[model samples]
Target: MNNLLTGLKNILGVGLKPGSYLNILYLLLAFPLGIFYFVYLITGFSIGLGLLYIFIGLPFLLLTMFSWRLFARFEGLQARWLLKENVEHDSPARWSEASGFWNWITSRLSSKYTWKGLVYLLLKAPLGVVSFIVTITLASVSGVLIIAPFIYKFVDYELPWGAISTMPQALSLTAFGLVLGLLSLHIFNGLAAVFRWLSRNLLNSGQRLAVAE
Candidate 1:
């Protein structure tokens, strides 16, 4: 009975938790960041590959590779900070440990994490779109409904059901909104968990694999 009660409390109290707000913020940032990452990465790769015949293309290719690594590292950090995920990032080989600069670069390029991170980065674009749309749509509807009492009279309010004119209607909608808000938090939490898993498995699992070998 006690455990059941605790579970119920957790479900209902999601909005009161600070983590819920963090999840929302993370989801909100996903759309813009995803678009930026997708555009930059695709452009960089296309340009780098297209110019490979020219001597200058070598530098472009190298720069694009380095850029992706840096982006991956930033994503790992962001996951740790926002989602409270402990992502053990892939570390580069030390210059001192390598025979030369080229050797160190090769070592980094050969690592499994390098490719995995790239895949994760690419996946973010689509995932971010879905997460952003769901978060915004649900939250906006709930917010407008919650505030319907105060704004119903002032604004020309019309939902799919109909216009809300009476205080009773507004109050009932507000109650429904509160429930919807709680559900949204749960959805956000689930999405955050997916990101956390991706970060842990793709962004930094190279270190663990290296140790195993």
Candidate 2:
């Protein structure tokens, strides 16, 4: 019985940990950032490629590549801070000191890492949406169920699925909520792991390129 109680305590405590909260925050931020990245890349690439025949498209495409590189670096930093993972990326060489705009563009275009960064940015939107939806839905449902007993008593109402008038019923709902909340935290942690993996592999120039080669 003591072992059972300890296990229960551990399960309940998982949701309240600081790291779990950070994972939640990271997932929440991913949604908006993903939408922005998807829109920006889609628009930029579409316009740039559409006008590739003209003289102007080359510069636009180069600019888009540079933008993706910067965004990848930012994502690496975010993962390091929020996911508490070490994401090492290769620093871009100082091409401006050596030559002009064309030189910098040529370097970016030639690098496989630049292309991988673009791929990561392109994938972020769908992954972000999935993670955000799952996290928010699970967290919200768990939260509501956890407090349903108190709310039912104070507001003189029962939940749609069942009544919470009796103490046992209320306790059951609370217990279920506790378990569900822990499950939600686990889900968040899992998604955080995936994002961290992506950041470490796709966003990092040095590691990804080396592995590919």
Candidate 3:
């Protein structure tokens, strides 16, 4: 019983932890970053493939691939910093140091990690949107409910559908919001865990293949 209470207290107190704040910040950033990545990927691929009939398409594709590699590296760094996890990737020699431009391009195109990174980028937008929406909604609703008593006392406002203009109602709403807010923290933590797993598996698990080669 004591252990359960302690665990509940710890979860409820998650906001005091630096990691919880960092995770929230990371999720908030993901919304915009995800949009940018999705836009860039679609635009770059369309332009590159559209011009493939001419030699221009090849260079465009190469540039796109190079840009994606850099973006993936940035994401890896972000994950490492925010998630506080080791995110590994293949060595530069595997794709960057080929004898010729074509060879370098071919190496990147053939690399498994490149395709995996592309998939990750594609999925990031949707995952980010979901995370951002849930986090913001929970935070906002919790904030409003937690302050219901003050709002009722000081402001002229109509109680929303199920809400009542009474002290007990206000206190009950506050308690509910507080519990929900703590649960939201746990949800955000779970999201951070998922992202860490994705980064470790998709962005950084090519070392063994590199060694084999």
Candidate 4:
């Protein structure tokens, strides 16, 4: 009985942790960032591929490659700050004045991280959509139910069981909503963990590029 009670407390008390809110915030931003990355990559690649024969597209393709590396670096920073993951500060490597522009460009083109980061950037678009949808849906439903007691009289409220007309019914709905909200927090935390793992693997996995003299 004690073990069961402890387990219940651990599951139900997720909202008490500050990290829960951080996870929610990260998940909330995932959708917009994912969409932006997708659009930028697609546009850059399309234009680059289309104009390659003219040689003008070479620069565009190079720019697109560099852009994704930067995006992956930012993602690592975000994971470190928001998800509390130990992600490298400089991922996919960046240009250095000492290294020379050509050396930097060659290092990036040859690094495995460049392609892995590209794959991650593309995958996040769909993942972000799922994260945003689930987070919004759960939070909205919980919020509405929690506030049922305060606005039931002003607005017509109906539940699956029946219509809510009495204070007792409203109070019951509020209680249920509170429980659901707690569960939603757990779900958000789980989603954040998934992103954290992905970031660690794709963004933080390989050795840093050595700067050529």
Worst 10 residues of 2 by lDDT: 204-213
**Runs of candidate 3 exceeding 4 Å displacement:** 1-6, 94-97, 154-163, 166-168, 205-213
* CA lDDT of each prediction against the hidden true structure: 0.86, 0.81, 0.80, 0.88
TM-score of each: 0.93, 0.84, 0.85, 0.90
User: Candidate 2 lDDT, tens digit per residue, 76-133?
Assistant: 8899899988877666557766387665555566666787778888888999999899
Model 4: per-residue Cα lDDT over 45-112, one tens digit each: 99999999999999999999989988998898889889999976333335764277776677777676
Q: Which ten residues in a row have the lowest lDDT in candidate 3?
A: 204-213
* Among all candidates shown, the one with the greatest lDDT: 4
RMSD, each candidate, Å?
2.6, 3.9, 3.2, 2.9
Q: After superposition, how far is residue 36 of candidate 4 from its true place, in Å?
A: 0.2
* Per-residue lDDT over 115-205 for candidate 3, one digit per residue giving the tens place of the 0 to 100 score: 7788777778999999899889988988988898888667543556754568887888789889888888999989888888888888874
What C-alpha lDDT, on a 0 to 100 scale, does residue 114 get in candidate 3?
78
- How many Å off is the CA of 138 in candidate 3? 0.6
Q: Which residue pairs in model 2 clash with each other?
A: none
Error of 1 at 116 (Å): 1.0
Least accurate 10 contiguous residues by lDDT in model 4: 89-98
Instruction: Record all residue pairs in model 3 with backbone atoms less than 3 Å apart, i.e. clashing.
Output: 88-204
